[model samples]
Target: MSFGFFNIPAPVNEPVKEYRPGSPEREAVKQAIATFRSQEADIPMYIGNEEIRTNQKVRLAPPHDHQHTLGYFHEGTAEHVNKAINAALSAKDAWAALPWEHRANIFLKAADLLAGPYRARINAATMLGQSKNAYQAEIDSACELIDFLRFNAKYMAEIYAQQPNSASGVWNRLEYRPLEGFVFALTPFNFTAIAGNLPAAPAMLGNTIVWKPAYTQVLSANVFMEVLKEAGLPDGVINLIYVDGPVAGDIIFNHADFAGIHFTGSTKVFQTIWGEIGANIHKYKSYPRIVGETGGKDFVLVHETADADEVAVGLVRGAFEYQGQKCSAASRAYIPSNLWSAVESKVKQFLSEVKMGGVEDFTNFVNAVIDERAFKKISAYIDEAKKSDQVEIVAGGNYDGSKGYFIEPTVIKVQDPAYRTMCEEIFGPVLSVYVYEPSYFDSIIKTVDQTSEYALTGSIFAKDRYIIERVSKALENAAGNFYINDKPTGAVVGQQPFGGARASGTNDKAGSALNLYRWLSARTIKETYVPPRHFGYPFLEAE
Candidate 1:
């Protein structure tokens, strides 16, 4: 007989390794990249334990070295999407019937695998395929993914442990059941961890998934599937596919069992998906859960009192790290007139020394943007800026796509605060700086708050406590992740649960228990030990 309740170990954030030159971690990832790059990987859709291959195929190549073919992935059609939905529904019963502890164990094992044996391969795959440097790859593919897996398992246990208080002669219980049907995980090209976590988080709560990774990210996506498989995840729990968004959305969104979609990508695409779901709301058996984290025109503001060197470092790192591709990257900055010269000098100095190229070179801090589309999009903005007398390119404005999608880390100092670069979400290494009068702090803060459509992330660098307090409260709604003297990017999983409001999709913090709750539908059960023989109430009888 089962007599005791189960508990998982308390979760903690995974430590990021500094993959310095000649370090073991550094060497391991390099070796893994070389070993895997030599062999071409063939990826096929997995539906109900069946590997489905189609004639339509797409080649997977590194963004940094586009001509080199890492592998090819078979494309799935609308029919394959239906099959994936069927596989999820078919596997729902037994998977849901299994104990929560057992489900958690699978994810926990996967985390351990990512932490140890599979770490280098996954990091290397991410580095090669996504054009992330070794450090960036390590953070995304190893540390963040492991944190999501382990922390989510512990969070699942915490959610299960919550129960309603029982009254006299009554037993109250709450059942945290998985969603009635299937989930769709549409992940972005930027973060391999986001891609892995989107599918795995739902599965940990007994929900099955139909995962579609960005076509460009399929190489690392395949490695993620391998780690999950080796960790003893059951077949059909998550069916990975490479399919067009329209075809996949048409099938999955209309299905009666369509449960939810875990998404991370552009705001335009997310709105399209949201509108379709609303149009087909009545077609589904249950109300589908819509959880997503989309684009951001994140910012950094420097007050007159801020240290020039500190502000410079924050702007340089926040706006250009990962080539400023992160949703939380600072694409815009507001610097007061008093600190402008000092901050500008330091920022330019840093950008001049920073190298931008292929990720294969360990010393290069800045790398290529994700693809040709991204390259063209960002380059267009730079060209537009060059034509405008309203803006000046202070540093790194040139771009070339002959070798890789490389755009020099650009800093655009705009005469107007309402410049297009400041308002628009340009997911590139282009930073728009607006210099404001030192005494106009209040009005400048207001302009900064109103300029961007996104409310994802922003930081304020100030030494004055009173001004810090004032700006903090004034621009509170401007960003979800607000920082003081820190870069807006590099949010730790357990510590800073990340997501934003307004145009930034649903703010259900991804790394926290709140996100896991979206995948679950709760049922409250109340049992009475003492039953009344008559239907009349006590108050009625007394009256």
Candidate 2:
């Protein structure tokens, strides 16, 4: 095939299916879930073209119904991580040397595969394996994942289109090079889209990858891998392994070929990974590029002039969707005292109407937390609130973990805004509301800006244009994906380039051109058409 300038299909956000009654998507997903529940899958670690199954295994169950066995996955050791690392390195040269178009084609094809034939199965796996309801799974596993793949391809083309301007008698060209060594993509359990993007983003830029998905997310991750494999992704270009974080870290961190890591998880884990890389800096062939997006104590600040209904709906949806597993989920809110009453009443009313259960039941608005650890951690906070006079559990403080890790949509009204629940990243469906005097809006903005180390996502609601402008400017650095009047959650790909700074992460702005830049290094080439025969003649004559 003759090489020529290639243009990727213009990227657009994948339309999220409503999965409403009698909808094709609804019935298809229901059938997919039913098909999945009838069997157990034994997933293995992928290295090159091989699937390696270890003696030890990790049993998998849905967070919404822990009693039901969905499947189990092979658990690998440090040796396996080493093998995956070796596999990535073995294919790095040929893979990176392949034309950029070919590389992008694989991901584009994979996106189409997911958007079409593989959509139902992927969504079903996410629902059964991760406890996400139909809508959440549709947005994450189906829509957002497709968006990442499609947009990343377009962004890759955009990056390659950038070139240096040339002067007379000189021609200048720039080339984007894949990282010299392998990239390790450490993905989280919250979003399967992120689980796919973290690795695929790096791989799309022609870097080979060793991906270690969160154990709780392996089922969906495996399906994602299958999609890529079927899309004609070359063998050994991207290896998948299921192993302990430390086991993988010990081997990967110290390896001489360790190039970089693409991470999305908790702040503590990202910190540990960063520290290990720093500790092993001397052992690596080059400085490893560390790109990560971590935890957030995200907030929503409502003004006196804000729409009461919108504020209420925003709080309920932002703080409780997917059981608030989103890193960008709103955990803290500052509502004007005048609006608090209406917002609280509406929020309570919404919660009263919300049904919590397995995702198989389409009527359920909220599902289970990822596991018991999350349930206990969140419930402990709620329990402390119940015991304290400083805060009131305004709504839904109940929890039932006998069958699954379920916590009702909880809202605690705190007198002290600095309370732990207000400042900390709960990573659950718990929102801490603090009603503030309208005159103290500016003061509270400053407080919200400085309250937590995180600045992932936050929202501002105000009908007053002055208030909107003032608050937006005041909380400028408060969030990466700042919302005008909408909820803090649901940062769409392409349109809202996601990420944040400080404790939140490196803020690489995934789903855009910026994130792709991380996996590549650039080389500038300048060719002089006319060369001076004598090196110093022009300067000497002029002088």
Q: List model 1 lDDT by residue over 389-419, tens digit each.
A: 9999999899989888899999999999898
- List, residue by residue over 55-87, the lDDT tens digit for candidate 2: 998999999899999888999988888889889
Supply every candidate's count of residue pairs whose N, Cα or C atoms clash at under 3 angstroms.
0, 0
In angstroms, give how far residue 541 of model 1 lies from its true place: 4.0
**Residue 500, candidate 2: C-alpha displacement in angstroms:** 0.3
| Model 1 alpha-carbon miss at residue 168, Å | 0.8
Question: What C-alpha RMSD separates each model from the true structure?
Answer: 1.1, 1.1
TM-score of each: 0.98, 0.99
